[model samples]
Target: MAGKTINPTRMELTRLKAKQKTALRGHKLLKDKRDGLMKQFMQEVRRTRQLRKRVEEGLAQANAAFTVASAVMSPEMLEQALMAPRLSTEVTVDQRNIMSIAVPVFHRAEQEAQPDLACYGFAQTSGELDDALQALNRVYSDLLELAQAEKTVQLLAQDIERTRRRVNALEYVVIPENQRNIRYITMKLEENERGNTTRLMKVKDMVLQDAHHYKS
Candidate 1:
């Protein structure tokens, strides 16, 4: 939109045309990248939704069983039963690339094969406690799956946002600006060419008039 900064010449027009071509190519590539990221992001979002629902339902069941157990058992007995944990889980953190974004992956490290939750004697503890422990164990893998899906969704969201911005920049700003510049340069070059041709024609007319007068 600003005034042209360079001299109006064929070379300048040529350079601007080349730049426009390159900008168009870059814009197309960015659009494709944005589309791909969107597809991946949508898939992750769906997976996260499903995993969250499953985890929530599992947690609710476990909590209800725990409440029943707490009410059924004597305070001292409940406290004693829960005083120690029977299972220890270790999680390993790593990263995997998705759509050029690094997403965290969590996996349980090597551990004793699914140990029993018999931290307290069954005679002292209510059956509700056993039910609650069983419910928790059943959902353990689902909880891990939910965590992985949520983290993946987060990373994909960030990547999609970044890609969208880039696409917008190329589509709305860079490519258009290059095109405008190219048009401006071409118009100026054509105007200058017409002016030079007019001046040359006027010079020829003057030369011809002078030669006719000398002959007379």
Candidate 2:
């Protein structure tokens, strides 16, 4: 007796072929998404680096301005000067979606300074007060932007990680299983075809022998 026989039905081969085709298409689509995600991640990394550099520069400037403003000006006058530069900050934050990730977008927070002559009433030059105020305000703005950029980059990094895992699963697990199943079904069908051919030949030979005996 045959150890085991596969069914010779055409349905098995047809189904296997269909599965293979579907797997191939899915594999290609996943690979494309992985590539696109990587590109977006790289771009965000570059922006993060540039923003960090800018923030450091702004901090240095603010520190220098504060030191000089304190040494050359009186506490009352300097306090007045600082208060004059007080800003009314209004932030309009929105989110930008890239590869299904929402990144923060800050529309240059609206800033307004209270103009008071009493704040500028000091022995220090107008240029010096103006310079210090500008430096301090720029530093504050830079810090805010850096925070947003850093947060955006961190979120994008996570997305890249998640996408990579999915890419690996499809490439290594799903498609390979489909291919293996298809191969097994194809071999089973071929084996069944050979066995059926052999049975047909044997039946024909037996019929011929019976006819010869009758003729005799």
Candidate 3:
């Protein structure tokens, strides 16, 4: 099946060789990119894990504090105290390219700064409410970071899979097929050259015989 559609000529051989060279180079580059992406993905996974643990712990503490506050305060008072928030945060999303993959970057684009998490008068809100709000505030940054890290890991993994497929195609399919075609073309060209040489020799021998007969 090799070189079935290819012309058995020097030109075709040269073209196949060039294509094979390019494929080999591309295969190497894709492999490198895959390796780099895998490394970045692992690092992001570790960071995400740590961020998740911290966020979970912070959330737990916040929940416990809220429970304690809820038990002591009347339902109406608790709802009224949290009616208005002092701090507001806005996140801006951008992208950064990693090995040709665009991964998300999150920034706190706009946020209102507050001296403390307390939005209500100290007289009305219990101390446990303050503790709960503080805990939620502390975890906010980590929660955003975890989101970014997890998203980056997902993008990297997808790119790595694509790169791996390309590498495999070039390594196991494209390059090998090109090599086989080149070999087939080369062999055919050599066989044609030998056949031409033999025919020329036969013609020469016939001419000599005719000259000898004419001389006799």
Candidate 4:
């Protein structure tokens, strides 16, 4: 069975209004997502550069320490010393979202220094060798952070891409489709209005003619 025809003006106005509201909302959300992604991407890039530089500097210092230690301490002795008591460390991870993109929290583990491993006095080992080993350990921690950060960046980048695709689809496909439906509905409503108007005019004319004939 055919459904009752809706009033053209009211139906068209309602549909068009809804379409406009939805389109505006979608546009704002998509723009915010795009902006947030760009900002995060730039931040991560800068962090990667700085971390790489620090890690390299740490590696160089460690090489120097190992060389100096080799002169006085046998490799076996140093190894044995290193194998002694170990300091415990914990790494904490936190997660947050930036415009639907996930950000990873990275932390490094800390350790107590044993400068005497180099066969030097506590004071002697505390200076260069300790600093070097600390730096080396820090570099290792940074490498781990770098790995996590890179993985996070990759995932975020992928999300940005996926969101862009969805935004585009909404802008071009879904909105356009709704708009077309609105247009089609509007046309039908207008046609229905005109048909109603013509019918009413004819009925009025027929009633007038009948009255005129009866009065004559």
lDDT of 1 at 4: 44
CA lDDT of each candidate?
A: 0.81, 0.71, 0.88, 0.70
Candidate RMSDs in order: 2.5, 5.0, 2.3, 5.5
Error of 2 at 129 (Å): 6.9
Give candidate 3 regions above 4 Å deviation: 113-115, 214-216
TM-score of each: 0.88, 0.74, 0.91, 0.70
lDDT of 3 at 86: 81
Q: Which structure is stronger by TM-score: 3 or 4?
A: 3
lDDT of 3 by residue, 1-216 (tens): 483588989998899999999999999989988888888889889989999999999999999999999999999999999988888888989999887788888887435565656778889778999999989888888888889999998888888888899999998999999989989998999999999999999888889889886432
Q: Write the per-residue lDDT of candidate 4 for residues 1-216, one digit (tens) a residue.
A: 113343446656597668778886987798688778878877877887787787778788888877776666666656654565445557778787766666777676556455333333353232545665666766788777777777767877887788788788888877776666666667777788899999999888889889886432
> What TM-score does structure 3 among the candidates reach?
0.91
- Who wins the TM-score comparison? 3
* Clash totals, every prediction: 0, 0, 0, 0
Q: 1 or 2, which is superior by lDDT? A: 1
Which model, 3 or 4, shows the larger lDDT?
3
Model 3 lowest lDDT segment of ten: 108-117
Candidate 2 lDDT (Cα, 0 to 1): 0.71
lDDT over C-alpha atoms for residue 143 of model 2? 74
